[model samples]
Target: MTYQNYSLKQLQQIDAAHYLHPFTDHKELRDIGSRMITRAEGPFIYDSEGTELLDGMAGLWCVNVGYGRTELAEAAYEQMKELPYYNSFFKCSTPTPVLLSKKLAELAPKNINQVFYGSSGSESNDTALRLVRHYWAIEGKPEKNRIISRKMAYHGSTVAGTSLGGMDGMHQQLGGAVPNIVHVMMPYAYELALPGESDHDFGLRAAKSVEDAILEAGAENVAAFIGEPIMGAGGVKIPPASYWPEVQRICRKYDVLLMLDEVITGYGRTGEWFAAQTFGIEADTITTAKALTSGYQPLSALLVGDRIAATLVDKGGEFYHGYTYSGHPVACAVALKNLEIIEREGLVERVKTDTGPYFAQMLKRISGHGLVGEVRSVGLMGAIEIVKDKATKERFSPVGSAAVAIRDHAIANGMMMRATGDSMILSPPLIWTRATIDMAGDRILKALDLAERDLRNA
Candidate 1:
C-alpha cells in the first residue's frame, strides 16, 4: 500500500533507467523524465505533487465514464474472487465473457452478434486481419487477402495493424510489413480537398480513391477496407458528411468487407454505442476496446457480423488465432459494469443531446483566436488547428512545435491535451458537464494565448 519509499526524483530516475514507454524517444524521456500522474477522479487527474488537471484526452481516449468509479473496481474484485484467471481455450468457458458478449451484441449493429476478445485494440486488429483473411480462404478465394487503408489513418501499432495503417514514419521502421495491404488518400477535406472543392465533392473523391484501389487490385484480390469513423490519433480528422456512405457503397459494389476501428470512438464516445451507428454504416468486423471497461481493465471485443460468423461456422474449421487473455473474466466483469454505468447514467444520450452540442458551441467561441485556423468536433472528440497564418492555414516552421507549445501551456494551466502534428486534440470524459466544458474552454484559451506570444516572438 505504500509506494512512496522512493522520492519523486528517485522514481523518475528509476523509470528512466528501466521503463521504456511506448511511442517514446527514450533519450528525450530520460532527459526530461516522465510526469508522474499519481491519481485521478471524475474528469480530472492529479500529478504526484497533487496538481489537478481537466482530463482532455480521457486517459488516451478511454475512461469514458470518467475516473475513480467504485462500481468498476468492485466488479473487478468480485470477478477475481470468483474466477480469477482462466484461459478461454480448449472448449473452456467463462460466465462474464458470455454475458458481456450478449450485452455487446445488443449494443452493436443488428447484423453483428459474435464477440472475440483481446487485451488491447492492437491485438483485436491483429485478430481481425487474420480472421478476415481466413474468411476468404475458407470461401475458396485465398487471393482475396489484400486490404485497403488510408494515408495517416491509425489502426494500431501491432505489425498487422501498422501494415494496414498508412503512417509513413511507422512504415519506415516497419521492415517487411504484412504484404498486400495498400493505402489510399484519407477523407480529410482540410488538406486533401481540391482548390475549391465542396466538402461533399471532396468526400466523394476521397471515397473514390478506395474504389480505385479496389479496381487496381481487381476486387477479387481485395479482402476488406479498414478505417476509423473519425480519425483519432491522426488529429481527430472527421471525414466529410458524404464520406462513409460513399465508401460503404463502393465497398459493397466490390463485395469488399468493411472493418471499423472503433478503438477510440467506441462505447458511446461518438454519442452512440458505436461510431458505425453514428455514421449509419455497417461493418463486417468492428475492432473495439478502450472505453469498454473505462480503462479500469484491459479488454477488447471484436464484434463479428453475422455474415462472417456464418461463414466461419458453416465452413467448419478452427480459426487458429487468439490471445491468452481472450475473454478475460475480470476484464469482462469490469466492462459489463462499465457499460451498465454508462446506460444507467445516460452518458451516451447526454453526449448526443446535451454536452456534445454545448461543447461544440463553446469550442466555436474560442475559434476567433488568431492562432486557430479551424475548430471541429464530433460528439466529445475535437481538434484545434494551430496555424501561423489563419488566412493561409500555414503551420509553424517545425511541424509540431506550435501545437506542442500549446499542449505544454495547456498542461501548465491545469488542462491535459495532446498535440498531434499541427493540431491540439481533445477527447474528454463523457461525464463532463456544461461547467466542465466552460472550464476546459478557459484553459484552452489561456493555453492558446500563451503559446501564440511565444510562437510569434520565436
Candidate 2:
C-alpha cells in the first residue's frame, strides 16, 4: 500500500528517519521536513497539504508530455503482463526493446542508428565513455582515451559522468574521479564574454578552448570531446550561433569524436527531437534520458552514430558493458507510448511554433524587475539571472543563497522553479500552453517582487 493511510506528519517522520535524498543536506532536511508530492496532472503537482503548484521545471526537466498520461500507464501495464522481465544477455532479446530501439533510431539524428540502453542518463553516459574509449582501443590506438568536457557542464552523477562533467562542488566530494577527463570553458556568453566582445567572437573563443585542450592532450591521445548542446543543469546556458559550428569544425579537424549529452534536451525540449539537430552538431554519439519516457519510467539511450557503431561492429568484439535494466521492456514500452503522444499531439512543433515564442515574450514582462538581471529562453527552456546590481550584472554574495530564497518564495506562491546557483531556471512541460505561461508569469513576478523586498531589507 502507498503512504495514503499514514498522516503527513507520520510520513515525514518515517522519511526523515530512513530516506536519504540525492544532493541534499540531511541535517537541514530533518529540520524542515520533506514536501510530499502526492499527485500530479497536466502541468500542476499537488502536495500532501493539498497546495496546487504549477511545475515550471517540469519535474526535474523530464515530464515533457505532462503528468497523468493514462496511455503511458496502460503501455507499462500491458508490457508488464506480457513480458514482465528479461535479459538481453546470452543471445536473448525482448521484442519491446527491439521495437523501441527502431523507433529511437528513426527519431534520432541521421547518422545515429544504433542504441545502447540503460536505466538513467548517468548509466548511458558511462556507456558512451566506455564505448568511445573502446572504439579507440579496438582501432589499435588505446592511448587515445582522454575526453574533453566543459566547466560547469552537467552530464550525470556516476563516476564517469562526474569525471566528464565540470562541476567543482561535485568534484570536491568525489575525492578521486576517473582519470583522463579534461574540462574547458563553456559557451556561456553572459558571464564569460570579454569587454566589447561580440557574442560571435566569444563563441569562437570558447570553441577554441576545445582545440587548445586537444592540442594540450595531444590530439592522438584524445578520444572525444563531449558536451551538452545547451548546458542544461549549467543554468540552461544556450550557446551563441557561432559556438557549435566552430566546435564541430575543431573536433572534425582533429578527428576527435564529438559526443553530446542530451539527457535534458532530448525528446523535443529544444523544439526538435534532439538538440544536436537544433544546433547543427554532427555528433558521433548522443546520450539521452529524462524525457524519453517522460519520467514515467527510468530509461536512457545512448544513440550511436554510424562512424563509431561501424568501428565497434567491424573491429571491437564483446566490448563488455551494460546494465540489467538496459532496454527494460516496461520502460521501453512507456517510452514508445510517450513518443507516440509527443508525435500525435505535435508537441515538438507546438514548442517550436506557438508556446515557445509566447513563453519568451511573457518572460520579457518581468525582465525589467528589480531582482532580475537578465531573462533568456529557447523553446520551453529558460533562465532568469538574479542580481544585486542590474547595470553591472552583479550577483548577491555567497552564490546560490539568494536564489534559494527566491525559489522558496516562488514555491510558496504556487510555482515550482529551480535555483541553480543564482539562476532561476524553467523547463516546463511541452504541453504547457499560453494560459499556463500566463499563470506562471504572474506567480513568478510576485515572487520576484517579494525577493526584491527581502534582499533590500537584509
Candidate 3:
C-alpha cells in the first residue's frame, strides 16, 4: 500500500500489466499512460506526477460533498467498528440501513414510503425493474411487463439498467437488449426540432412518443416507463417545460408505473433534492445513488411509493430480490453523514436560491458565441453544445471527436470535464462557489477556443 518508494513510470507499467479498466479499450489504454491520481481534496485532485486539477465533473457526477470529507470517513470507521456488514435478507437488519431508509423516505419524493438498498446506481435501477415486474405480477397482470425509456438517456451498466438506458452504442455492444424494453425520442428541441418548430409544440410531439409506444406495445403488456428528469449523460439534454407534465398524464392514462431514475439528479444536483420534485412529476418509484453518499461510499436506494409497497406486501410473502451487500452498515453510515453535511451546510437551499442562478447566468453568456449552439442548465448540471455553424446548428463532420478535444484542452488547462458528441458538459461539486464557477467557465471557454482554432486549421 505504500506508494512512496515507486516512481510514476513504475506505477504506469504495473497498471498496464495488471489493471483492467471499465468502459475503456484495454489495448489502447495500455499504449497510452493512464493519469493515476493519488489524492483528492475539496474538488481538486493530485495525480502521481503531482499536478493539481480542478474537478468540474464532480467525480463522475457524484462527490457532491466535495472530496476528502474526513467526517464521512470517520462515520464509516465508527460503523465498521460496531458492525462491518450485515444483510437485509432473511429478517436480518441493521440500524444504519433502517435509519438511512427513514431519512430517504423523508427526503425523497412525496408518497414514496419504502426504501430498497443496493450497492450502486446500476443495481438500484435493476432493482426497480424487478420491483415493477413483481408489483404487476402481484396485481394478477403479469402480462403488463414492458418498460419504456428515452433515447440517449444513461441509466446504468447492468443488464436491465443498460437495456433501459437508451445509448445505442452500449445496446449494440450487448446485442439484443433485455426484451420488452423500448425507447422514445428524447425531447431535445435544439437537435430534433424541425425548421421553425416552437418549443411547446415540439415538447408535446416528443411527449406523445411515449403514448404512441405504449399503444404500439399494447398497454396491457407495458409495466413501467422510466426516465431521468434531466437526462444526464445524454448530452445533458434538458427537456422542455411541457414535456414532463404531458408524460405524467400519459403514464396515468395507462396503468403504467412512472419511475424516475434520479441517480445523477438527486441530492442537490438539480437544486431540488430530486429532479421529480423540480419537474413536478409524480413518480411511483425512484432510483437514487451517486451523491447519496457523495461518492464517500458505494450505496444506492430504490424508493417505492405506497401503492407499489402495498401491492408487494399484500400479495407477497417472501421477497427474493436483494443484494448480499444491500444494506451494508458502513455504506449506510457514510450516506447518513453525507446527507447530514448537505442539510447542515444548507447546500441544497444554496443551490436553489444562489448557486443555481449564478451558474445559469454564467452559462447563458455562451448563447451568442458563434461556435456554441446552446447553453442549457438546471442547477449544477449543464452542457454547452459546440456547433460548426450558428444559424444552421451544424455539428462537426467527424462527430464526437471535437468535443473530446475540448475535454482534453480543459484537462490541459488544469480542469476536469466530460464531453459527449458535440456537447461539453459540467457537473461541479455541490459545494462549488461563484469564484469556482467563474474560473470553470473561463477554463471551459478556453478549451472551446482551442477546439475552434483546431477545427479552422483542419
Candidate 4:
C-alpha cells in the first residue's frame, strides 16, 4: 500500500494488472511495462527507476509553469482548507472563480469577457458544443446546428468533443461521429500542399474548403466552426500565414460563429495568451484548459465573447447546462496563482522572443537528416515528421510506427516526446530555456538516428 512497500517490478506488475490508461494500446503497454513516474521538478520528471527525463511534451501539453511548483500546491492547499467545494450554481459562487474569471478576461482576447468553468479540456469542449447549439436554438434558429471542424484536429475525448474533433480513428471506434458535425480539410502544408504551389494560394484554397462545406451543408444549418490554432495533438501543425485569416473571413461571410479551441495552444504555449491572437482570428467563443492551471489542478473554461453572452442571457434563464464541479474553488485558486507566476516571470513574452525561436532553430537542425521529412514549429510547439523516403515524402510502414519508435527512443534516452502518426512532436514547458532545449535536442537527435538505423536494418 505504501510507496516503499512495492519494488519497481512489483509496481509494474500491479499496474499491468489493474491500470487502464487512456490513448494506450493496453497489450503493448503490458508487454513493455509502465514507465512509472514518481516525482518531478522544473520540466523534469524522475521515474521510479530514478531516471531523469526531460518533459518535451509538457505533461500532456499542460504544465506551462513546469513541474513541482510549491506555490500552486500551497495555493490549492490554502483554498481547499477554506472553500474547496463551492459551485457556481444556485446563487452560490466562490472567490476563486471570481478571481480566475477576471484573470481569464484579462488574459483572453478583447471582447471575450464571460468564462464558464469545467474540470477538463474535454468537458470545456463539450460545453462549447452545448453552448453553441443552445445559442442557435435560443435565437429560434434550431436548424442552424452543424459544427464544422478540420480533419485531424483534436478537440477532446468526450462523446461530443470527439464528434467535434476530426480524427477518424477516434470516430470509427465510437460508432461514427456525432451527427451534424462536419470536417473540412486541414491545412497541413507539408502533407497536403502540392508541389510548386504557393503557401498563400494553398492557404486560400484550404480556407475555401470551409466555405465549401458550409455551402454544402447550407449556411443556415451551420452553428459554429471550432479549431485549434496550431492543431496541437494533430502534430503541432502550424498553418500557413493566410490560412486562418481567410478562414476567419469565410466564417464571417457564412455568419458562422468561430470557436477557437485553445486547449493546448492557449495560455503561453503559442507565445501568446491564445492562439487566436497568434493567428489573428477573432473568435466568438474560445475553449481553454491545460495551461490554465498549468496542470497543477484540474480546471478548464469556455470564454464566451460579449456577443455570445449577451444573446444567451437575453434569450433565457435555466441554461440547463454545466458540470457539477464546474468552477471548483481549489482549481480556480491554483489557476489564479499559476497565471500570476506566468505573468511575474514573463513566460509568455519569453516564449515570443527567446525560447521559442531558439527551440525552432534547434529543431531545424534535426531536419535534413535522411529520416526527417519535415520539421514544423510555432512558438514553443513543434513536430518532426519521420519518413522512409524523404525524397518522395514517403511515410514509414504501419503509418505511424516510425514516429512511435522515435518516441520510444527518446524516452529511453531520457526525454519524453509524443508521436501522432509519423509526426514526432515536442511541446516543452513554456519556461524551458535554451539549456533545457539543448539537453532535449540531444535525446531527439539520438532518437532520430536510432529510428533511421532501425528502419534501414529492418
**Candidate 2 error regions (>4 Å):** none
Tens digits of lDDT, candidate 4, 347-429: 99999999999999998888878899889888899999888998898887899999888888889898999988889988889
Q: Rank by lDDT, highest first.
A: 1, 2, 3, 4
Q: What would the TM-scores of all predictions be?
A: 0.99, 0.99, 0.98, 0.98
Q: Candidates 2 and 3: which is better by lDDT?
A: 2
Residue ranges of candidate 1 with Cα displaced over 4 Å: none
Better of 1 and 3 by TM-score: 1
At residue 350, give the lDDT of candidate 4. Answer: 97
What's the residue-level lDDT of 169 in candidate 2?
90
Root-mean-square deviation of each candidate, in angstroms? 0.8, 0.8, 1.0, 1.1
Residues 1-458, model 3: lDDT tens digits: 68868888898899899999988999999888799899999979889888988898899999998999999999999998999987877788999999998999899877998999999999999999988998888788989999999899888999888899999899989887889899999999998989888999899999999999999999999999999998888888998999999999999998888999999999999889998889998899999999999988899999899999988787776667888899899999999999999999999999999999999988997666667888999999999988889888888888987888889999999889998888988899999999988888888788888888998788
Pairs that collide, model 1: none
| Clashing pairs for predicted structure model 3, backbone only | none
The TM-score between candidate 1 and the true structure equals 0.99
lDDT (Cα, 0-100) at 190 in candidate 3 = 90
Q: How many backbone clashes does candidate 3 have?
A: 0
Misplaced by over 4 Å in model 3 are: none
What is the C-alpha RMSD, rounded to one decimal, of candidate 1? 0.8
lDDT of each: 0.94, 0.93, 0.90, 0.89
